[model samples]
Target: MTEMEWEGEFDPMSDPEEQRHLLSVLDSFRSYRRLAHFNGTHVRRQAFYSLPQEHWTLLSKPPFSVLDSFSKLDDLIDCNAELAEAIFKAGFRAFLAPTLDSDWVASVVPKKYADDDFRTYSIIMDNMKVQTSQNDMEKARSCINQFYREWSAEGAVERSKCFEPVLVALQHEFDMRKEADPGLDRSAVHVLAPGAGLGRLVFDICRAGFSVEGNEISYHELMASSLILNHTENVGQFKIAPFALSCSNHLSRTDQFQEFQIPDVHPSSELADAIGSKVPAHERMSMATGDFCVLYSQHEHKHEFDAVATVFFIDTAPNVIRYIETVRNCLKPDGIWINLGPLLWHHISRKEDDEREDKSRGRRDVVDAGISDPGSVELTNNEVIALVEHLGFVIITQKFNAFESGYMSNPRSMLQSSYRPAFWIARRKPSSS
Candidate 1:
């Protein structure tokens, strides 16, 4: 969310818990960059050396050119290193300096996190020696890959398949409302998008003449998205080799090292062009950084949104019933609720539950947020719809197997996975039954 207001001048470092969290996030980025170098050079070289000498000699010829492959891999590593550096710099800036300076920071960030003193604190964090786990490196790598999914030209096809339908449904809703009430203003339509990773769908909704707020809980995602949304000045301003670290499922070496320009379209410029001087783009778009249930379930948010649109988001909940209830609370009477996603429940697996527990262990904010449920209740697509219908929603339109889509997929990879997500538009009843 935009910077919140504080009752007094707050000091972020005063809170030991917040200080630790901030340092941990910064260290994760640093470790990610360091691991990229190790993986790109030392690990690959060791693997090359492990091969039989005779086979290496034979493969060193024109057909295989083992040495040449090493050189190419090195070059790819350099590209990835550059991308990692950019990610670190951007993430650091977003964490320390948000768009609007306020005494109170976003929920995930410490209060008064943007103070100039934090820059000095960042240096201390950089100098501190901390052990980085494999899991941290993997999470950092996934954050980089998300850039490819949300902001690159290559990701547009997937976005179109997944995001377009939601936009269309919203537009239809807006049109119907305007037709029924001739004096309705387009700018009055406010939409809440939960699990809004990188905010591509939120940006699309803003472009379609609606005020939209994107809610995200992951600091990794919020940091990266803030860079793209608020900091990016031009299209193709940044380039990243998202697939560089993946050594498997490659049809060709080129595919593994492919580079993609971020922000296929510059956010501000596109918004300005689509929405002229009548209303400023910044006022229409915002982000809320916290758990969706915690933030939206507050009484102030009740009946505050005209519509709630979810894209590949519902499955992340530990309890889908709470999600539905939160949605119901957020909407006005006869408000629209649009959902598109698969039934891949994020908390179903024991491994995922363990990860969640580990991440939430020492954080009081997380524990107090009421999200520490042990496991999720997995439901079939039809069962999910039945729950929605039973929870005081009238299905307006729904299509099962709406379309097949991919998430952060590499088009040139030898192996690709897809999901056949369900799509539905439902309206909240005047009151719960």
Candidate 2:
């Protein structure tokens, strides 16, 4: 065994290369941070399984186009080898941890570029996109920006991280929806991904035949996602719309999601351009943003959607109670709520325990934001379950053992990295009151 194994978890810290692998993953984010609106707030911490197996129904077919099928699926996928090859270039190897070993990585990756195994989409394509350092982020931004500039493209579609599990969850939801309502328009599904940094998760859903809209609060990040998604759907013969893009919680246009490489819509009149984008006449897509809590009811869109998903989202919102309430308001009583990712104590580290570690690293801004809300405060898994149950919904299924699911990538490449995702596929308890 690699020196990286531990008793309760997969341990990679013991290996000589452990530091290199972990450092590589950590460094990836810096690159994104420089060009992105992310404030070094949260790190992924652990790895999760993603792609074809977990969310098969989505990658099964294309979801979007500027208007129609101008690009053939065969054409875009033909470059799959090129895309896969680009991943291992230079420092990206850090994404693979020391514990992974040659055999595992080889299994997940195509044996040879021309190998028949490469003919299979799932065998070749894996969304292993993870965090890197600022310099890498800068390089990525520069390259992406240049790609857009040269191609006269608008944006690249960002797909959700940990793709396989997301797909699995999506497949389960799709089956349930069909069973629940036979006449339902399968395509009427519209997903709202808040804090859609780089549009990863949003695009994954979009690839599933659902209409998606990402509500981003950060400006540059929005620009990056918008640029990639917009341009990808435009120039590529395999053009596909990632999702409906927009930024809310933003009072000013400049302050919303905009990545470094992308240029303003009109450059001179950003606010006017945003207004124009919303005009319905000039827009290539649709979008809106508001507090998810009471947002549906406030907007009079109560019981509007068939499903409202939160992937690595609930952790960001400390108020699970209000968050669920808001999600409940939007979902039809019989609608499904597929909640994934950790209910992390992160997004808000405990401020009261200042004496436990460093006091200078105090988080006054977030604490003041809502650190006072008892329900919003971080709690244990048991606490999460009690709260969700009290909210009057039933937990359907959760796969906390994704690490054991046997994906080709060993999640614990760095330290004891592994993921535990929970789901509460619930229906609103019929109100007797």
For residues 1-433, write the lDDT of model 2, one tens digit per residue.
0111001111234443333333433333223322232221111111111334545444334452211221221222223213222322222222234434556557666556435432322232243343343443433444333333222233221122344555566667766777988765435665556556545455445545555555543223433444444433222422211110122243332222222222313221322233312222112223343234423434476766766667667776656666766666666665666766665655366444322212222223334222133444677667876776687666666555443221111122222233556645565665500
- Total clashing pairs in model 2: 50
Q: Give the Å error, residue 212, model 2.
A: 2.9
* Collision pairs in model 1: 1-287, 1-288, 1-289
Model 1, backbone clash pairs (residues 3+ apart or across chains), number: 3
- Cα error, residue 222 of model 1, in Å, equals 0.6
Candidate 2 structure lDDT: 0.41
Stretch of 10 with least lDDT, candidate 2? 1-10
Best-performing candidate as measured by TM-score: 1
For lDDT, the strongest prediction is 1
Q: Supply candidate 1's per-residue lDDT for 402.
A: 57
Cα shift from native, residue 175, model 2 (Å) = 3.3
lDDT of each: 0.72, 0.41
